[model samples]
Target: MGGDCESNVENIIEVKNLKKTYISRGHVTEALRGISFAVKKGEIFGILGVNGAGKSTTLNITIGLLTPSSGTVRIFGKNFFQHESELKNQMNIATAYADLAGNLTVYRNLKIYALMYNVPNYKKKIADLLESFGISHLADKWVGDLSAGEKTRVNLCKSLINDPELLLLDEPTASLDPSIASHVRRLILKLQKDRNMTVVFTSHNMPEVEEMCDRVALLHKGKVYMVDTPDSLVKIHTAPDLEEVFIRLAKGELEE
Candidate 1:
């Protein structure tokens, strides 16, 4: 059908047979074992997994930060490696593990990234982003002086400096309190809708994943266990919720 074909062509990111192996001190550790998935345009796709499940590895590869041992990543229907420079301009990531410069003021940090991305009217862009996150008052404050939640909000503001088409968020709400996390989630959804952005999200919070993701990929021990809507996965697995499904997958009780 024409509609089906159109939808397939709209996949903004296509990862094929992705694998990554790390060799440390003559010891080999497989971080990814041929995982593949596609993120459609204007949708929030979640990658769900426990620790060491290859979620971060997959994201690293997708962003061209890590070279895949044997795989192909296509973004905007072009080979990602071949067009990494151009592709990177259209993508940005926010992760708890990667922090902004601690010595810089919040505004200064965002300004540096905006210049890197060559964003126009960067001052206004930064101001609006900080305002949206309700942290405009922290602009003059040193990043090191901010609390964990405030720092997280600043990191998020930096990620949007480019107004990227593809946004990758890894454990985005990890350190925020319940109210702030909830507000962040709502803001993300609004941004995606307003900008028609394609988002790749990874979070350990099952309920949050269910609430935010349009679809989810469950990764277990470096392989994809399943991919489906959250409600559908729960129904198919006959589980009470995504948390239970995650538990079963992690414990290897749902192995195919």
Candidate 2:
């Protein structure tokens, strides 16, 4: 009930009892403490948390980039770690944390990824993505030389080249200007509408979450403070917007 479970297998991402901890120089830090949530099909599920709220940790484990300290993360009903190739085929991750090969041109970068995924008609697919994002002009330029905004757009294109069933985005539009950010948001919403893609995105921008997500979970101190529809949560919490609720949760005003 907390996360719209029991709705249908229409649910694309299912996470249960997930936990992660870091031990650096014998100092134990619990990053994610028993987190649980699920994103249904065709929804832009938002995970809102401040810095070090374990958003990146949760994403890393879910995408199998980092081994979990404990618990499970499933994409499209299969565990990511157990079914690497298949889960990867079903999912794609995009974040600023990812490294782009400095030597590769944007076109080369995507071409390599497309080939890796064995995406059919790779050349045509690449063309389509470039045109979709209006990045064709930068195709031949080295990825390292691109502006941050261009690189961000390219990163999105890289994740989307395979047309994944589940897309993970972390602060996707963080560095872009307002107009570009708006365009990026619209593109994401369009992807959700047109492809019915299940998305789990972490963002600090409340209005963006309110506009893009059907549901959101506010995380703080390695715990999910609440999960609900933006409208419903706003009404129940008596807040004018998500930002206010985020403050309440982040400040430890909510119950554990």
Q: Which segments of candidate 1 are over 4 A away from where they belong? A: 1-7
The lDDT values for all models are: 0.91, 0.84
> Tens-digit lDDT track for model 2 on 104-204?
99989999999888899988998888888878899899999988989999999999999998899999988788998999899888988999888989998
Question: 1-256 in candidate 1: lDDT tens per residue?
Answer: 0001122578998888888999999999999888878889998999998999999998888888899999788888888999999999999999998889899999999999999999999999999999999999999999999999999999999888999999999899999999999999999999999999999999999999999999999998888888888999999999999999999988999874
Q: On a 0 to 1 TM-score scale, where does candidate 2 land against the true structure?
A: 0.95
Candidate 2: residue 166 lDDT (0-100): 87
Candidate 1's displacement at residue 76, Å, is: 1.0
Q: All predictions: root-mean-square deviation over Cα?
A: 3.0, 1.6
In the predicted model 1, the residue pairs found to clash are: none
Error (Å) of candidate 2 at residue 253 is 2.0
